[model samples]
Target: MTVKEIREKSNAELLNDIETLKAELFNLRFQQATGQLTNPARMREIKKSIARIKTVMTERELSNQD
Candidate 1:
């Protein structure tokens, strides 16, 4: 997800997305372990997306503390 898209979502939605992405990441890792992964690049994409979401979440938290 793009930063703009992530920023547009509510905190609840972002949290849900994070949980879902984490589950997918776990599944992808399992597939890799079994040599069944068709797209290893997806793992990287998911990680980056998770980072982007967390960054936005932190930004919001810090702004709120001001």
Candidate 2:
């Protein structure tokens, strides 16, 4: 997901997206292990996306805590 797309999502939606992306990343890892992955670079993209979601989630949480 692009940062712009992510910025548009509400926190609940972002959480849902994170869950979905993690599942997909898990599947991709399995595919990579089995040499069935069509695009190995996808793992990197997914990983980065996950990080972005988590970062935003944390930022929001921290702000709320203040």
Question: What TM-score do all the candidates reach, one by one?
Answer: 0.99, 0.88
| Model 2 pairs whose backbones collide | none
Question: For candidate 2, lDDT tens digit of each residue in 13-54?
Answer: 998998999999999999989989999898999999999988
TM-score of 2: 0.88
Under the 3 Å rule for N, CA and C atoms, how many clashes does model 1 have? 0
> Model 1 compared with the native: what TM-score?
0.99
Best by lDDT: 1
Per-residue lDDT of candidate 1, residues 18-62 (tens digit): 999999999999999999999999999999999999999999999
RMSD of each: 0.3, 1.1
